[model samples]
Target: MDIRTLQEELVQYSKTIGIDKIGFASASPFIELKERLVRQQELGYQSGFEEPDLDKRTNPELVLPQAKSIIAIALAYPSKLKDAPRSTRSERRGIFCRASWGQDYHDVLRDRLRKLEAFLQERVPTCKVKSMVDTGELSDRAVAERAGIGWSGKNCAIITPEFGSYVYLGEMITDLPFIPDKPIEDNCGTCTKCIDACPTGALIQGGQLDSNKCIAFITQTKGFIADQYREKIGNRLYGCDTCQLVCPENKGKDFHFHEEMEPDPEVVKPVLKPLLSMSNREFKERFGSISGSWRGKKPIQRNAIIALAHYKDQSAIDELKKVLIEDPRPVMRGTAAWAIGKIDGESSQEILLNAKNKEKDQDVLNEIEKGLQLITR
Candidate 1:
C-alpha cells in the first residue's frame, strides 16, 4: 500500500464528512507531554477529570498495539450566537461557554471518526484503528499540535490559523504508517491577554493553568463554591470563556459551518430563576443535548444560584427561599441560604432566621448564619 497516497485520500475523505481540518502524526510516545502532565499533577493543577494513568495517556502503543500513526481532526464551532436572548434585571440569564453551546462535540466528532475508520477499513482491511474524543486517555490538544492541526496557544488551547481557538479536536490511532505533518509554530508571542482576562487568574504565566482556580473547572463542581470565587464566576453556568473570548487570534473568527454546532440562545443562556426550580427530568430534556449537561443539573443549578447572587436579583428571592427550605441537597440549600443573604430581600432576614432553627446540617446552618449577617448588614 502507498501510505502517502492513502494519507492524501484520507484528507479528502475527511473534508467530505464535515471535518474542517485533518492532519497525520507519528504515533510515537508523547515524551514532552508526559513530563508536563507529571508537573501539573505535582503542582495539583489537574482538574481530576483526566485519565489517571500517565503511561496509558502518553503511549499510543498501549492503547492500540503496533500503532504507527495518528490522524487528528478539528471542527470549528460558532463563536457568536445569533439573536441571543437579552438578560434583563427581572429575567437574569446565565451562559454556557461556546464549547458547550452546541450539541456535545464528543458525539459529533466520534461520528466523524467512525466514518473515517470505516473508510480506512474498506481500503486496508487488515488495518486496526482506535478513535478518541476529549475524554480519551490521549491529550487531544497534544495530538492536534503534533499533527500540525494548530499551535498550542497561551490559553492552553489549540489555536489554528484558519479557525482560531474555537475548534473541537479529536484523533484516531492506526496501524497505517502515514507520513507525519510538521507542527505549526507557536504564534502567541508576548500575548498576555488570555492570562490577564482570566477571572480567577487561573492562567499562570502563559501556557500553564491552575485548574483549581479556573472558573471553567469550578463551575462543574457539585459542591458549595468558596466565597472568593462566587462573585468571580459571574453568570457562568457551565464553563468560563474569558480566556478564549479575549484571545486576539480568536477575534472576528466566528464560524457557523456545521448545523449541529449552532446554539439555541434560550438553552445556552437560560433565565437563572427558572433553572433553580427545574426538575431532573426537565433539566435533562432541555439541556441534555448540550455538552454542559454531562455534569448533571446539580452543578448548573448551583451556579445559577450563585449567578442570581452576583446580580443581587431580588426578584428571585421567593424561589431562593423555596430552595433553601425544600431542596434535599445540602449544597443547594446552603448555597441558596448564602444567595438569599446576597440578594437581601424585604423578608430575606426573617426567612433565614426561620430556616436557621430547622436546618440540621452544620454546613447549612453556617450558611444560614452568613445569610443572617449579610441581611442585617
Candidate 2:
C-alpha cells in the first residue's frame, strides 16, 4: 500500500466522518514543550491534572513505541448558545463554560479517532496506532500546532482560522511515515486581549498559564475556593471562558457543525438555587452527559454557592441556610455559610451563629465566623 494514498484516503474519510480539520505531523520529540513543562513544574504552575511524566508527555515515541507520524484532528464546538435564557435577579443562574456546554468532547472525539484508526488499520494491516483525546500523554496542542491544524494562541489554545479557539483537539500516533504538514505561523502577534481578560491573571504571559490562578482550573477543584478568587468566580458554575470569549479571532465564530455539541440552555446555564439542593442522583440525571460533571457535583455546587454570593441573591438565603446546616460535605456547608453572610439576609447572622454552634468541622466553623463577620461588616 502506498502510504501517501493511505494518508489521503484517511483525510477524506475524516471529512466524511465529520472532522472539522485534519493535519499530519512527524511523531518527533517535543523538545520545546519539555523545557516549558520543566519550567512550569519549577514554578508550581501545573494544574495537577496533566500527565506527570515529562518524557512521556513530550515524546510520542514513549507513548507509542512504533510511532512514526501523528494525525491531528479538531472538531469545532458552538461558542454561543442559541435562544439562551437570561439570568434575572429573581432566578439567578450560573454558567458552565462553553467547553462544557454540550456532550463530553472526549466521547465525541474518541468515537471519531476510533473510526479513523479503523480506516487506517483496514488499509495498512501491519500498521500500529494509538489514539488519545485530552487525557492522552502527548500534548494535543503541540501535536495540532506541529501539524498545521492551528497556531498556538496567546490564550494557550489552538486557534484555527476557521474555528478560532473554540475547537476540540484529538490526535493519533501511527507507525507509518505519513508526510508531515508545516506549522501555522503565530497569528496572535500583538493581541493582548486574552491575557488582559483573564480574571485571575492565570495567563502569566502569552501561551503560558498558571493553572493554580486559572478560574477554569479553580472551578474544578474539590476543596474550598481561596478568599481572593471566591468573589471573582462570579456566576461561573464550571470552567471559565473569559480569555477565549475576549479573543478577537473568535469574533462571530460560532459553529454548530456537531449536533452533540449544542447546549441545552437549561442544563448548561442552570438556576443557582436548585443546584444547592440537588441530590447526587439528580445531578447525574441532569448533568451526567456533559464534560463538566466529570469532577462530580460537589465543585459545581460549591461554585453555585459562591455565585449566589456574587449576586447577593437574597432569594437564595433559605437554600444557603439549608446547605449550611444540613449538607454533609464540609466544603458545601462552609461555602454556604460564607454565601449567607455575603448575601446579608435579615436572618443571615442568626443562621451563621446557629451553624457555628453545631458545625463540628473547624473549617465550617471558620467559615461561619467569617459569614458573621461579613454580615457585621
Candidate 3:
C-alpha cells in the first residue's frame, strides 16, 4: 500500500479507537518550545503535567528512540450544559472545565492512542510505533498544530474548528514516513478575550500562563495558598474556565451534540454539601473512574470549602461544620472553618465559637480565627 493509503487506514483505526479528531504530522524538532521548557521547569510550573525532570521533557529522544513521524489526535470532551440554570451570574462554580468534565481525558485519550499504535505495529511488523499522551517528551500541542488538527490559539491551546480547545491531545511517534500537513497560522489577531478573562492574571502575555498565580495550579499545589490569592480564586472548585468561556472562537458554538465529551452527571456543578460529606473511601469509590479522582478527594474537598466560603452559601454550613470537626486532613478542617465563617455569618456565631474551642490543630485554629474575624467584620 502507498503511504497515503496506509495513513488513511490508521485514521479509520483511530475512529474505532474513540478519537474524535485525528491529524498527521511528520516528526520535526521544536527548538522554540524546548527553550521555553527550561524556564517552565525552573519556575516549578509543569507539576502534574510531567514528573520533575527538565531533561526528560526537553528532549524528544526520551519519548521515542528512533522517532521519525508523529500522528497527533484530538478527543473532544463534550462541553454540554445540563438542563438547568447553570452558567449563572451568582456563580459559585463547583464544576470542572469542559476539558475535564467527563472521564479522565488522559485515560480515554491514551487507551485510544495505544490501540492505534498496536494496529500500526500489526500492519508493519518491523516498524516501531509508540503511543503517548503527555508522557512523551514530544511537543503534543506543537505536533497537533502542524498536523492541521488545529492552530495554536492565543490561549496556547490547539484550537480546531470541530471542538475548540476542549479536545484532548495524544500522539503516535513512529518510524514510518507519511505525508505531513501544513500548519495554519494564528487567527487571533487583535483578540484578547481569553487573556483578559483569566481571573488570576495567569495569562500575562499572549500564549503564556504563570502557573504560580493560576488557580488551577494553586488548587493542586501541596502548600497553603497565599493570603492575597484567596478572593481571586473565586468559587472555582476544580479548574477555571473563564478563559475558554470568553473566547470569541468558542462563542455561539454549541458542543451539546457530542456524546464522547459529555460530562458525568455526578460532578456537573455538584452541590458543595454532597462533596464535603464524602468519606475518603466513598470519594475513591465514587470518583475513581472520573477525571476529578486523580488528585483524590482532599484537593477537591478543600477547593469546595473555599468555594462555599467565597460564595457565602448557608446551605454548606452543616457540611462545613462536620468537616471542621472530623476530617482527618488538617487542611480540610482549616479550609472548612474559613468557609463556615464566610457562610454561616452572624447566624453561625455559636458554631464558630464552639469550633474555635474544639479546634486543636494550630493551622486549623488560625483559620477558625480568620473565619471568626470575617464574621465580626
Which one wins by lDDT: 1 or 3? 1
RMSD of 2: 0.9
> What is the lDDT, from 0 to 100, of the residue 360 in candidate 3?
80
Give the C-alpha miss distance for residue 132 in model 3, angstroms: 1.1
> How many pairs of residues in model 2 come into backbone collision?
0
lDDT of 2: 0.93
lDDT (10s digit) by residue, model 3, range 262-342: 666656566566778787788877666666567777778787777777778776677788888888788888888877777
* Cα lDDT, model 1, residue 361: 100
Q: Give the 10-residue window scoring lowest on summed lDDT in candidate 1.
A: 368-377
lDDT of 1 at 129: 96
Give the alpha carbon lDDT tens digit for every residue of 23-84 in model 2. Answer: 99999899999999999999999999999999999999999997899999999999888999
Tens digit of per-residue lDDT, candidate 1, span 28-81: 999999999999999999999999999989999999999999999999999999
Candidate 2's C-alpha runs over 4 A off are none
